[model samples]
Target: MYQLKTKETENSVIEFIENVEQPKKREDAYRLLDIFSETTGYPAKMWGPSIIGFGSYHYKYATGHEGDAPLVGFSPRKAKISLYFATGDTAREALLEQLGKHTAGKGCVYINKVADINEDILKELIQQSVQFLKETYPAEE
Candidate 1:
């Protein structure tokens, strides 16, 4: 399971954001924090070294692979902001097309900056991803 040592990581995330020399990037991180909180209705917390996460869920597969993960999260990376949607292959081509300028990896969306994307579309993407994850994994007690 991916257990988060929240106390240690939370301060790290805050400091990391605070030290971002680019004023625009720093502001974007704060904006993303608010967007994530509003979308998840859960307070933001750091997950591991860099990710700002919200909520959590447990998953167990038939193959005995099981773990707990943040419901949704993002990390501010040097080249781009990595948005963790946890819906790697769920056919979101339509959303991606409308998401403005961004690239994606197997399980994450990489945006150079919030200014480079449509905020409304990004919010919809986040909301849809959260809904998809909830339905796919459903939380386990």
Candidate 2:
């Protein structure tokens, strides 16, 4: 059984951002906190030690692996800020094309700063991620 390293914690998101070493990264973190919160319509939560996440959905894979993950999240790493969005969403690729300056990884998008990308497109990615996850892994009511 594989355990996920990044699980949601009770840590304060603001506190985490304040502790970020780089002044620019710290400032960007705060800006991202607001953007993610307003865009997702859900409050921010600390995921693992660094990721600031909003909204969550449980997923079970065909191989029987199951876990809960945030619908969208970001981490202000020293090298680059990582944006976490739904990998299954086809629209993500199209949005990223218009997302300005950013690098896409296997599961995360890396940006130097928020200004390097379009906030409106970022919000769309967040919205589409949440919608795709909810639809793909519909929560049990």
Candidate 3:
């Protein structure tokens, strides 16, 4: 199993957010932090170098790949924010249609600005993603 190196907690995440230079980006990050915290009921934490994550789960695939990862997370990128959701089979086509203006890539949904999307729909997406992860991984602890 791949072990997580960084401590997953609020202080570390807050410090990282504080260091963000751009005011708009920082504010967006803070909003995302609040949304993820409220939706997942897990305090925000720094994952690796840039990702802000919530909760965690351990996974072991039949192919022998194993690791522990955050149940949900997002990274504030230069061009857009990348929201992570591990929904391999669960289709979110309906939700995406209602998600407003945005793009997607692999396991990430990208948004240029939160203002361009519906806040309520965003929260619903987070909640649905959390539910999917819980059912797929079924937390060991």
Residue pairs with clashing backbones, model 2: none
Tens-place lDDT digits, model 2, residues 1-141? 688988999999999999999999999999999999998899999989989999899999999999988999999999999999999677999999999999999899999998899999999999999999999999998
User: Deviation in angstroms for 99 in model 3?
Assistant: 0.9
Using all chains and alpha carbons, the TM-scores for the candidates as numbered come to 0.85, 0.97, 0.87
Return the candidate ranking by lDDT, descending.
Answer: 2, 3, 1
Clashing pairs in 3: none
Off by over 4 Å in 1: 1-13, 88-91
Per-residue lDDT tens digits of candidate 3, residues 39-115?
Answer: 88998877788889888877789998777788888888888888887767455667778988899877789988778
Give the winner by lDDT: 2 or 3: 2
**Which residue segments of model 3 deviate by more than 4 Å?**
1-11, 89-91
* Local error of candidate 2 at residue 138 (angstroms): 0.3
* Whole-model lDDT per candidate: 0.79, 0.93, 0.80
Using lDDT, give the best candidate's number. Answer: 2
